[model samples]
Target: MQGIIDRQLDVLIYPEIGMDPMSVQLASLRLAPVQVATWGHPETTGLPTIDYYLSAEELEPPRAQENYTEQLITLPNLGCFYRPWGGEAIRLDLGKLGIDPRSPLLLCPGMPFKYARQHDWVFAEIARRLGRCQFVFFIPEVTNLAEALRRRLEAVFAQYGLNFDEYVIFIPWLNGPAFDGLLERADVFLDTIGFSGFNTAMQAVEQGSPIVTREGRFLRGRLASGILKRIGLQELIAGSEEDYISLAVKLIRDGEYRDRVRKRIETERHVLFEDMAPIRALENFLAKVAN
Candidate 1:
């Protein structure tokens, strides 16, 4: 660590840190004079030595800087350049998975840990309100925590008066092509609140599926929203839990509105993918810090 720091790196960024203990340990050390935290985890590292949290200006909400201990450096646009994984490919067959082709399908793709326990109520509420819809959940191969989450969600359904069979389908992770195929079949992609899904949202948008996102106070929470903004579809951005549920239900049920957003995503998506404003913002920040 000392050797790397000795080379005089003007900026060393810990892309994401909170989840990994080693990152926290390294963060405890003053490695770089202008060390920055970025969207890898998108939350505060709470390290005194870590100087800044670089995020998109539009991605964060008002007063978002208040959330972090370090000085906040909100970049305009995405704050980074990225590419969507995989490409146009064969989608998964819903029939093989026992999913009815006619049913409204909502895909929630994220790690089990990203799904907070309190979020079950939102799912339960959606089910109760929508009355009929299928939620596809991708669980990790290791069943311990994922299975526990399924059971807990089932309980939430019961508590919320959802008496439907197999309302939530728990399945194993799909490989890139198969996952893209499955994403093609979904009508609405529900983003995990708090810690948003950046790549998953991109994949879903690439598949031309409308997504429901709620902008969070933190940078992590606003990732998917930033992506959505890139595509020029703010109607899908939900401001509250009720708004999230309403937008999801609307996207699931209203074919016209859903198709409009899907069309926007398909036709205007290039604006979202290749913008270099963020790269410029980052470069400027590095230059300013170095000076």
Candidate 2:
């Protein structure tokens, strides 16, 4: 680390951290390396070694950067990391999963546990509104701390009188192939706030399920709104909690709107893959770094 700083490296890329004493040591020397942070929350470290915090337009002026530091450089819309399963290629055996294709299956890819607490309430309300409808929730494998948090969330569900066994069927995480199968069996995909499921949402949409999401201040929240808007499904994007619940309830109750969203998503699935915005941004970023 000392040698790299002494040599004045072109760039140094690393993930975000809360606070590391070593960063203070590095910053004291006034290192000129261009630091880039990715994947985690778009925040600042207030370290002088850190020259730039890289992030998408959605996360522009990352919360930490806004409140703590001014080292953020907002990138153009680089798009999400995951792609939806192309609708035409997805196939499923509903009977094997004990799901009846004839019955409405509301598929929520993963529980909103981390930052989106509203999902807990939204999903519970969804279960209440669509009583007895088969709702399949795919629970992701969380680590030690995250697992503990998930347990607390589950307890909250019970407190709200939501019977996980009756309304929701918990499915273990699967590999790509198995996940695709689940998507095929699902009738609709639900999104969380402050950060939508980019890959999961796209897969659900591609698999012919209409995705319903709420917009928020950050990129994590605005993803669904942006994608739906881009693909001409703006009507499916909810503006608030009430709007999200109303849309979900309407989709479950109004056959015409539900079918229309489904068909429209299927018809427009290709556009997401073919879109050039993400590609161009990636190319530009790579070029800048290379130079």
Candidate 3:
């Protein structure tokens, strides 16, 4: 088999989790002088050749950092890596989605079946509590493997007597203009906890949708909490299942609190997108490694 020729590469950056060991082994053998870095927290590769592990301010120091042998370089709070839409773009048309904008409540379930984030029960429970309000779910097309796993998830939903066809309103995945349109339609984005929704949660917040997240253990749980706190939305971070439910209920029922969070997010949107501190730090680190 052919090998990685070191002369062709200067640096290697792994963006997501789950790296193949063979790739690491091959890279180490040929790319010795080349720098390698990992981002998005998959714990460690246990490879001696990896030069650095990249993290964010949300990740607690010495914990995620301590577990890995590579030097840890922390990225400044980039808010969330979501594309932002201008304030003028936020539309108030829940009616088109078969929902009333004034309808006391709306639940934004951003869970994908592959991650075992079966929040069907939580949605149903919230619906039961809210009574008159509506719960909206974004149903994405499941991969074949995800579909197989979804059967078990469906059973859990059925046990609660919640039918997917009845509760979930389909919102096709959008990009560019369409994606902005979808974000403008929702009020609050409910984050998943069993495994958290990292990218989606940030996108929701960026588009002026307030995010309500439940804290969990390790990387997944801490991500949204970390981002919200950094952005001064700490009040929106819910710590338990009951807290999740209560916050959802309060955000819907209490007009004052809901308005406060909504306005705060709107005020912070520009600061989040234009902030260059994180970008500068990342560039500086990259330049140092490249040198």
| Top-TM-score candidate index | 1
lDDT of 3 by residue, 101-123 (tens): 66553545554542444554666
Tell me the whole-model lDDT of each prediction, alpha carbons only.
Answer: 0.82, 0.63, 0.62
Residue ranges of candidate 1 with Cα displaced over 4 Å: none
Query: What is the TM-score of each predicted model, taking all chains together?
Result: 0.93, 0.73, 0.76
Task: Give the C-alpha lDDT of model 2.
Answer: 0.63
Residues 43-130, candidate 2: write the lDDT tens digits: 4555555555665564342463554353555554535444544434436676676665666788776543533554567767777777
Ranking by lDDT: 1, 2, 3
Candidate 3 Cα errors over 4 Å, as ranges? 1-10, 17-34, 40-43, 79-111, 114-120, 139-154, 161-166, 287-291
| Tens digits of per-residue lDDT for model 1, 64-178 | 8789888888776776666766466676678788776777998989788888887778888888777778888887878788888788888888887786455888778888888
Candidates sorted on TM-score, descending: 1, 3, 2
lDDT at residue 247 of model 2 (Cα atoms):
86
RMSD to truth, every model: 1.8, 4.7, 4.0
Q: By lDDT, who's the top model here?
A: 1
